[model samples]
Structure formats: structure tokens, C-alpha cells
Target chain A: MKTPVYISHPGLVTPLGLGVQQNFTEITNGNIAIQKHSRTDIAKEPFYAAMVSEAAINEAFKSHGAISEYTKLEKMMLLSALETLDNSEVKISDKTLLIVATTKGNIDVLDKDSAFNSERAYLPNLAKTLGDFLGVTATPVVISNACVSGILAVAVAKRLISSGGYDNALILSGDLVSRFTLSGFQSFQAISDLPCKPYSKYRNGITLGEAASSVFVSTIKPTQFAVQVLGDGSCNDANHISGPSRTGEGLFKSVQDAMKEAKIDAHEVDFISAHGTATIYNDEMEAIAFNRAALHGSLLHSLKGIFGHTLGASGLLETVIALEMMKQELILPSTGFDTLGVSKPLAIVETIKHQPINILLKTASGFGGCNTAVVFKKVS
Target chain B: MRNGALFAEIDAANFEGFLKQLYVMLDCKYPKFFKMDTLSKLAFMGAELLLSEISENSSEHKRTALVFSNRSSSLETDRKHQEAISSHGEQYPSPAVFVYTLPNIGVGEVAIRHKLQTENAFFVFETFEPEFLQKYTVSLLNENKCDQVLCGWVEVDGNERHGFFYVVGRNGKWKHSAATIKNFFEHD
Candidate 1:
């Protein structure tokens, strides 16, 4: 209980805007990142994606110095992590544990005829590459549990720091949104022609996006930050390998467990960061889950509207965005929302602003029925 | 609570012995679900043996959750799934073979048998990272989404399977501890 894991600082690079300050201000102003996807020839499917500008990615690598070929997904990782380290004024070293969260590390590189070794798809190799880039040879632990990877990474880093294994742990999450994911999601038919609209009526499918974020979690008790990770829960639906449960039963238990862990009631949550992918089933299931859990947040939204669905990066990426939202005193509007979809009468953030963030519930679900929820309270 | 673990080892010679060991463990339950019919079934068999009586109850369909990780992600199933697509045209592959493509789906099958309408998640790592295993397990436990977590490392190669499980508790608020392998692989 003495482990004061404070989010000293956060860094992010996404389609919305690069740099933590830029994104934070935009999030406060309720800016959205929806844009038509670049290069639509492969499947040629009509869809929108919140794509990061190549100029921003190039600038990130330049600032980090020449990234070696061995470092898979280093481009995105360095961009976000460096931003965090710079913002937090923390130095990276052997003493700092670099915990990376990702699903596909470098599968994108392997797909193309790249010069680097294609075998970086494995876990340890990918970890080493990331650690090497940070000038820390200490083994990086990569958590690859489909979409809920951010909370998964947080869980891992929290244990290490709280257990006195490391002085500081960097929770970095990103996805190298590859042709594989696009093709796979396309095959599953989970993509929407229009931008994804979560939790509202006339909601379409999800639009995929990419993000890399770094959060400096330390055992320091700071009285100023807006939020802290009070509790977290993750469970496998065990219902279907590829599809989510019809009842959202797994998500219910996860929320219940997280609340029990946090020692709070459902009514205490001021806002809920739902995993509203805008898919017909995913949205319906979440709507059903909220009603069954009897959980209501004063204001609710899915950052997927702003960042698209960053897949594995969605959990932490959205969580990081939520923290920034807390700092900015805003509850972001759910972008791409048109009308109400489910009968739950839940307050889905459809317009451009909701305010005064205090206690928030964040949830994310993935393939293999992986569902996770984490509670963050404003650390005043 | 120091739980006494039952470890049953099986090789070519103790194949029948393994079956008998499983039978005794099942406690008069129907033996058909213990589908140790082939070399491909060792993980299913070994995991079944490890769970002993806990897995054979009437609540086998949905009440139970499967949490497993491995280096070899269904090599046997992958070869067969590929063969079906290759032989019977790419579009018309066997649904039975195509279904087990993910390493975590076996848990769903076990849940379908148990009625475990709870949280089930699968982790894929190079070798089991102790920090990842302990933290992830504790998170699920602390959340109270899962009553008993069957966290383990299960490996299968040819006719051999080596796997272990530790049924741990999250209710104690062991949220963020860098638990050692003893905490993860050892119970009691």
C-alpha cells in the first residue's frame, strides 16, 4: 500500500495532434481526429482512420536519433516515450523498468520484404529491441493480450513498482496497425465505411487508428495530479474465441470486480470511458452491460471517436487521453455519433463537451473475449 | 491456505497409467470428456489431470474459465487447418479446424462444457514472464470478476505436454506485487 504509483507525466502522438500539450489542449476543446484513411487500394474499402502524419513520426525518430532496424515498432514507441520522458524530466536507465504493451510488434515489417530480421515477431526479441532503443539493456516485458494491452501493461508495471522490484516503470503502449490487422478486421467485416460512432443511434462499425503513448509511473505521492489508478480488472469472456458474448456477462463481472477492488459503488463513477467500438454487437453488448450492472456515469464517451480504434493500444491510449481529459476538466464528446442505438437511456457523450471529470471508469474488450476495466480517481 | 497439489506424470510407458490416474481423479464421472485419444490431446489430457476433480463437475460448461499460454501456439491444429484449406480450396476449410486458430479458444471449449460466464483472457509470451503473470492474475482477482483463476503455463510438442496451474486469490488485495515464480507456479 506504500507504493505511490503516480502518473507524473504523460506523452502521446496520434492523429489528433502530436505532443502531450497539443493533444491535451485539443481534448479540452473537444477536437476530433476523424479523417479518410490514406491509401485505400488493398481491400479498397471505404473507411475513415485517425492516421498520424508522416511528418510527425519522422520528427519523433529524428529527435530520438537514428532508430536501428532491430527496434520493431520503435518509431511509434520512441515518439511517445521520449515525449513522456522529456515532459516528466525523468532519465531512462537500467534502474527504470520499460514495460511495453503491444499486440503485433513488427509483423508489419515482416509482411513487407524488409532488410531486418523478420523474427522480431516473438516477445523477447521485440522486448530487447525496445529496451535497446531506450539505452537500457534491461529486458523489457511486452504484454500482448489483444486489445486490452494497456491495462495489462499497467497491471504488470504496477506490480513491479509496488513490489519494490523497480524504482520507476514506464508504461508504453502502441500498435503498428498493419495490413494484417486491416485485412483481418476486414475479413471479420468489423470495419465501417463511415467514421465509427460509439453508443449513439445509427452507429456504424469502428475505424482503425494507431497510437504510441508513454506514461511515467513512479512511487511518488504527488498531491496535484487529477487522477490515479485505484483499481483494475480483466477477464476472458470464454464465450467465443472471435466474438464477444451476447449478454456482456464477462464485462459485468469485470466491472463488479474492479469496483469491489476499488471499494466503491457503481454510483460513484462520474464518467465512464466505454469500449464502444460502434460495431452492431459491441455497442449493443456494452449497452446491455451498463443496464445490467446498474452503473451510470455522469458523463460518458469513447476516445475511439477521436483516435479511431487503436486496437491493442486502445486501452492505454484511451486511458492516457482520459487522464489528460481529467487534467483539462473536460469529458470528451463521442465523435461520429448520430442517434441513440440501445434502449439503456445511458448518457453517451454525443456532442462536443462534458465537464468536471473526477472519478472515471475505463473499459476495453478484445478478440478472444478479453475484457478489462480500470478505475482512476482524481488525485487531489 | 496451503493447497496440496496433485502432479501426475505421463510418458510412453505410463500412458495407461496416466489414463487410470485421470479416471481416479474424475471420481465416477463420464470419461468421454477426457479426450486423450491422440498425441494432439496431451495438453487437454495434462490440463485435465492437473485440475483433477475440479474440472469434471456438472458446472463444466460455462462456469469455468481457461487461462493458458504457450510458445507453440497450436502447431498441430495449424498444420491441419492449413491442410484443409490447401486441399479443399482456400474458402471451404473445415470450420472445426478453423475455429481453434487462436491459442486461447481451448478455454472457451472448456467453458462451453462448464457454463463459466465469467472473465477469460489468454496471454501469449515468449516464455512466461513472472511479473506479467502475477500482475495480470491479481488484476483480474482484485477486480472480483473471476472467483478462481486457473493461471498456468502449458506447452505441447509432438506427443509430450508440460503444464502447471496455480489457483490463486485476488480478493486479498494483492494488486501490485512482483510475485516470484514460487507464487505463480507453486501453490500452498
Candidate 2:
């Protein structure tokens, strides 16, 4: 029999709050983080985004290490990883692996007026910095795949641990809403002016957000609420570098492959944590993919309405939230969703409901035509 | 180069010129080759050279995964995008350039060219970690994720261009191990 991997000890730092419980409580109480930000350093015009408070991050990080030595993204990532390490019994050792996931790390350093050296923008350098801070001896791995970097990191951790390469793996994923990303999204005209309404007919574009989340994957169960990493599949559409496939070919295959590996059918999944970025094409494509996978009966919700699109952190952040929902036996609603917009219909959750969630599926699709689907099962 | 032997050396001035000359020598007809950035061009060239002999059957393509790593993660295109949005330039960032800002786009470009819809991952390391790559690719194959994997280190930063790509399969003449991979990367 193959070794089973379990995931637990979620650590989150987002616009909503610091800890996983805090963010979960805030989302349960119907709170959102996206707001209008007129910061000239990030954008030329006011844009809506879910931004973590720098003041909060600085205050929280003050107790851990010297504040000036780390970049904002590093501070957020370090704090999240520290929480995971402290809350769990796992210890850092030569066999322990650290995976850092991000599309752009310390990207602010590239700005003309930045304080730090531009070399910090390199992904490997950022991973090394995090590894040193976390007391990880093994050479850290960095995944720079567009937005799917987060959960894909988790999948990588599971594979490494299962392959007997590591005792346990700590995966930290973070990305900032900086001038680089904001300007690029603006160039594509993909940024929304209002809080995003995913899967709604009136939805216009994505609302960018910033966050850092950490998850520990190991062969041993870390907590009672720990979930088993049943299976995962990542596929590239092989169509466009920037745009998602209209036929949802990659996502459809990903979900199908994941479920096949997990030895489960479409009817077995209780709920889905979808990558609903509130963009027209993305939502439509997801709807088609879900229908194609025969997942129309599963309750689906996109946390983007609450956290906005957290880029690299979205996949893992939403997966962490899904785990919490399974533990709490509650289904969170899709915050900004209204009428069904996509041509194919999806069972979008509209309100919080107490239900037994045994099997959960998390899916993410991002730039470079990449799509990832991971299946998780609640431990009883 | 095939089997560590020089197939043909192009006489050109710079990296771009060398790529153009190589493209002509290879007789590549794909128009998208001209639009890709330097990183994607290098990766594409390497993938084309390696996969040219493989059959064009879609099922075979479906069982092939693309595993790539690099030191500089799309720094060339990132510099261009940053310049456009900086105060020094017109502040009009082109979507085309911004799309290639991520290192995986090069992998995506190769996937699109070869129509690979299997597992894909792009890692960034300080230097090439052959042991890690060997283990990870083996695990993917052992786990039945894919039958064959195209794995390598493709690093392109301005004038510095280097790519080492090879195909790993269930049956091979040479063992797919860290020492062998390191030898191939170093000797080439």
C-alpha cells in the first residue's frame, strides 16, 4: 500500500485576519476584506483590492524577528510559517522540506524607490530566506507557476513525503498586490472596479488581493481534524499562455484525473472550493468544466468574494478554509454571487448551511493555462 | 546537440541572432516562435530538438509531462515590463510582455507547441538540483502520473542563456539517476 499523506496545522495571514480561526470566524460572520485603495505606489488610479494592513503585519511580526530585515511579503510568509511550526509538533531537521510558492516574491524590491536589494526578487533567494528563518536545513524548493503555485506546492509536498524524501513538508505561499501585478492586470483590463461577484452575470473582472498561507503535509496525522490528501492532478491547457481554455479541457481533465486516483466518483464529493475569479471567461469556463465533470450536484463556492483573488495564495488559502468548513460541518456561501451567469449551471452555495462534508474537492486554474485539482477526505 | 555531439553550430553575432540562425537551420514553420521571449525561445528550441523524433500521436502526447526549473525566473521579460511601467518609460505595460513574466510560460509555450496536457511543474533553485529532479520525476512516473517526462533546467537572462533538456521514460538505455543527469548537464 502507498503511504497516506495528511494535511493540518493551517496558518493564514490575510486581509481578513492573522490566524486560521480568525479568518474563518470573520468569513462565517459575513465579513469581506476588499476595499477601494487609492495608494499611488500600487496603482495610478484607485482600485478595489483585499489588502493586508501593513501596520497589523508589522505589529504581529515584531515579536518574531527584526522587522527591517525582511520584506513585507517575507514578513507575512514568515509569520504564517511560524504559526504552523509553533502549533504543530513537527520539528525542523535535515529531513524536513520547505516549499515556498509565489508568483512574485519581494517584487516590491524591483521598484525604483525600494529599500532592499533587487536580488531579493529572485524566487530562490526568497525561498532561502524563508528556509533560514524557519530553521529548515534542507534546500528549500520554490514553485513559481502562476496562480496555482499555492495548492500545487501542497501537492508537491505530498508527493515528496510519500516518495520517502522527507519526514514532513511545510509549504508557505504568498504574493502581494504590488505595482508590478496591478499594472499588469490593468494592462489586460482584467481588474474589477468593484468588489468581485464571482459567477454572477453582472460580474466584470477580478479584484486582486494579498495573502500568505501555510500548510503542513506529513505521513502522520498532526491533528484530529487533519484531512487525508487523497489525490491531485495538474494539467496545462496547452492553448494560451494568458487565457484559459474556452472548452475547459485542462480543468475537466484535471478533475477527472484527480477523482480517478482518489477512487471516487463525481457523486462522492460533497462540496467544491472553486477558483472563481469573477472574470467572465474564468467563471464560464469553470461552470462548463464542473458540468463536464458531472459535479453539478456538489455545493460550490468561491472564496474570492471574501478574499478577492489572492493570486498565488488563493489555492492554498481556499483549501485551508475548506478544511475548516469540513471540520465545522458548515458550508460557507459564495459572498458576491447572485444569478447564475455561465451557460452551464453550477450549484453555487448562497448561504451558510450546516451539513456533513466528508469529501471535498479544491480546484484552481491560472495563467500559463495551468489547472490543478486536489481531493481531500475528512478524518472521522 | 544530439547525444552530446554538435549537430550544427550557427555563425551569429548575439543570442538572438544565433537563435534565428538555428531556427532557420531547423526549418521551424511555427509563427509563434517569433513572438515568444528569449526564455521561451530557448526552451522551445530544446523541446523541439528532443521531441522531434517522438511520434505525433495525441495519446502519446497526453502521457508526457513537462518538468522544468530555472535560476532566473523570467527576469528578462520582467525587466521589460518593469521598464514600461516605471517612470522612465511610457508606463503602458503591454499584456504580451506581462504574460511571459512567469517562468512557467516557457513551459506552457512548449506544451502548446507539443500539445502536452499532462502533469506540469516549474521550479526555481539557486542551481540545478539533479538529485531532486531525478527523485521527483521518478515519483511522478512511479505514481502513474505520466509515462514519460520532459525534464530540464532552462535558464535565460539577457546574454546568459543555458538549457539542458532530456526525455525520461520507463525504458531507457541509460539509467535516470542524479549522477547521470549531473554528468549530462555538466559535460554538455
Candidate 3:
């Protein structure tokens, strides 16, 4: 029998707040962190986004004292990982692996006014720096598959542990809202003028955000809360580079594969944490995919409204939030979603409710037509 | 395993001509080839040369996975995208250039070309590690997550571009092992 991987102690630093408890409180309270910002460094026009404050980041690092030069993004990643590793028996030894997931790590370094070296912009270099900070002895792995990077990192970690390559894996997923990313999204006309209303009739586009979230994937069960990674799968749409597949082919297949691997029926999934970017095509495609997969009736929610689309960080961060929700046995409403928008109908959670969530499925779809689905079961 | 490999080192000045030469050599008619950025172009040409022999079947396509890695990620297109937006107050970002700024788009290009709806992953390492590549591929196969996998390193550094793509499956003359992959890249 293969070793089972359990997720434990997820650390999150988002615009919502630091750590899981604070973010969970805000999420359950139906509070949103997205706000309009006119940062000259990001864009000339005012863009609505969820941005982690520099004060919060500096405050998080103050207790650790100064280390050598580390960029803001690096500091965010380190702080989140440190929070997850604190008071844990897990050791950063050779048996432990590090997987850093991001779309554009340190892309802000590309700016002419930036002081950090351009080399730090490389994903592998960023991974190495994070590995060194954590004292990981093995070569760090970097996953940069657009928005799916974070959720896919968890899948990769689970597979590695199941394959007996490592006993534990530290998975950190993050991305910052920089001029580069903002410009790219604007170019695609996928940026929302207002807070994104995912799967809503009036939804326009995504509200970008920045965050760093960490989850420790290990074979050993934790003393506290944890979830078992039952199964995971990824598929490409083979359709478009930027737009989601019109037929939702990749996502449907990915969900089917994950369910098959988990040896469960669609009815077994108590709830779903979906990737609802609120873009017309993406949300519509997800609805089509979920319907086709027979998950249309499941209680589903997208956390994008609370934490605007966090790009690479969305997948893992959302998973972490789902874990907390599972422990609380509460289903948070899909904020910003009011009316059904897509062609196919979906059971978008519209009200916060205290309900038992035994098995939850997390799915993410991103640019380059990538889709990933991972199924997790609550530990009793 | 049924496998193929190709490599190209453009003179940097005539990179377009080199790509055109590859297009002619492969006898491919995909016009989208010219629209792709440099990184996608390299990956596209490599996939064409590597997967040219595999027959297309609906079920087989679903069983094949594309796993790739690189050192530069998408630096080539990133610089261009950055240039477009920051060009002396031009502030005009091209949607085309912005789309290719992510490294995994190369895998998307190949997936679109061949219609591969299988498991795909892209990793970034300082340098190519044969062991990681081989182990990951084998794990997928062992778990029955995939029946076949096309994986290797595709890198683009300035004027220099190199790609080593090979197919691994139950049927093939070349064995899918770390040493074999190392030998294939080392041979050229």
C-alpha cells in the first residue's frame, strides 16, 4: 500500500490577515479584502485588488530580526513558511522536500527602479533562496504553471510522499500584484473594474491579489487538525493559451480522473472549492465542467471574492482555507455571487451555514488551459 | 520506448530564419507557429520532431503526459513583454506578448498542436536533473496516472537554444531510464 499524505498547519499571509485563524474569521464573517488602489508601481489607472500591506510583512519579520538582503516577495514566502513550521516537530532535513509554486516570482525586480538583482526573478533561483532559508538539503523544486501552480504543488507533494521519495514536503505558493502581472491581465481585458463576482450574472472579470500561503504535506499524521489527500489529477485543455476551453474539456477530465483515483462517486464530495476567476469564459467553463462531472448539486464556493484572484497563490491558499472551514464544519458563502450567471446551473453557496463537510474537492484552472483537481477527506 | 530528439543553436541574428528552416524541414503546416514567442517556438519545433512518429488515437492522446522543465523559464518573452509596456512612455502592452510570458505556455503550445489532454507539469530547476525527471515520469506510469509520457528539458538562453525531448511508453527500443535520458542528451 502507498503511503498517505496528510496536510497540516497551513500558513497564510493575505490581505485578509496573517495566519489561518484571522483569515478564517474574516472569511466566515463575509468580509472582503479587495479594495481600489492607485499605486503608480502597479498601474496608472485605479485597479481594484487585494494587496498585502508592507507594514504587515515588515511586522511579521520584525521578530525574526534582519537577515541578508531578501526581496519583499521572498520575505512574504519565508514568513508564511516559518509560521507553518513553528512549534512543529517536522525537520527540514534531506528527507524533507521543498516545492515553491508561483507564476511570477519577484517579477517586480524587472522594474528599472528596483534595487534587487534581476537574477532573483528566475523561479528556480527564488526556489533556491527559499530552500536555503528553510535549511532544505535537497534541490528545491519550482512549479510555475500559471494559476494552477499552488493546487498542483499539493498534488505533486502528495505523489512524492506516496512514491516514498520524501517523508515531508513544504509547499509554499505565492504571487504578487506587480506592474508586469497587472499589465498582462489588463492586456487580456480580464481585469475587473469592481470586486469580482464569480459565477454571478453581473460578473465582469478578475480582481487580482497578492498572498503567500504554505502547507506542510507529510506522511506522518499531525497532533492537531489535518486532511488526507485522497487523490489528485491535472489535465490540459489542449485548446487555448489564454482563454479557458469553451467545452471545459480539460477540467471535466481532470475532475473525472480525481474522482476515479479517490474511488468515490460525485455524491461523495460534500463540498467543492472551485476556481471561479469571475471572467465570463472561465466561470462559464467551470460551470459546464462541474455539471458534466455530476458535481452540479454539491455545495460549491469560490473564495476569490474574499481574496481577489491571488493568481499562483489562489490554489493552495484556497485549499488551506477549505481545511479550516472543514474543521469548523461551516460552509462560507461564495461572496460576490448573487445570481446564477453561467449557462449551466450550479449550487453556488449563497449563505454561510454550519454544516458538516466530510469530503471536499478543490479544483483550479488557469492560463495555458491547465486544470487540476485534488480530493481531500476530513480526518476524524 | 519510441523516441526522437532535436536541437538547434541559432546564430541569434538569424533566429527567425533558423525557425523557418525547422518549419520547412519538418514539413508542418501550422501557421500559428510564427505567432508564438521564441520559447514556444523552440518547444513547438521540438515536440513536432519528437512526436512525429506517434499515431494519434483518442484514448492514447488522453493517456500521454507532457512533463517539461527549464532554467530560463520564460525570460525571453518576459523581456519582450516588459519592453512593450515600458518602452519610453509607450505603456502599450501587446496581448500576444503578454500571453507567452509564462514558461508553461510552451507545454500548452505542444498540447494544442497534438491535442494532448493528459497530465502536464512544468518545473524549474537550476539545471537539468535526470533523476528527478526520470523518477517523476516513472511514478506517473507506475501509478497508472499515465500510460506514456513525453518529458525532457527545453531551454532558451539568448541566441542559444537547446531541446531534448523523447517519448516513454511500454513499447520502445530505447529504455526509459535516467542513464538513458542522460546519454541521449549527452550524445548530441
Q: How well docked is model 2, in DockQ terms?
A: 0.83
Candidate number of the best lDDT: 2
**Candidate 3: pairs in clash:** B1-B172, B1-B173
The TM-score of chain B in candidate 3 is: 0.88
| Model 1: per-residue Cα lDDT over B105-133, one tens digit each | 56554444445556555555566566656
TM-score of 3: 0.96
User: For residues A65-167, could you state the per-residue lDDT of candidate 3 as single tens digits?
Assistant: 4633788888889889988998875667788889999999988888888888888888888998888877888999899999999999998888878887788
Here, model 1's chain A TM-score works out at: 0.91
User: What is the alpha-carbon interface RMSD for each candidate?
Assistant: 4.3, 0.7, 0.9
Ranking by lDDT: 2, 3, 1
Q: What would the TM-scores of all predictions be?
A: 0.79, 0.98, 0.96
| DockQ scores for all predicted structures | 0.26, 0.83, 0.77
lDDT accuracy of residue B157 in candidate 3: 68
Error of 2 at A130 (Å): 0.6
Better of 1 and 3 by DockQ: 3
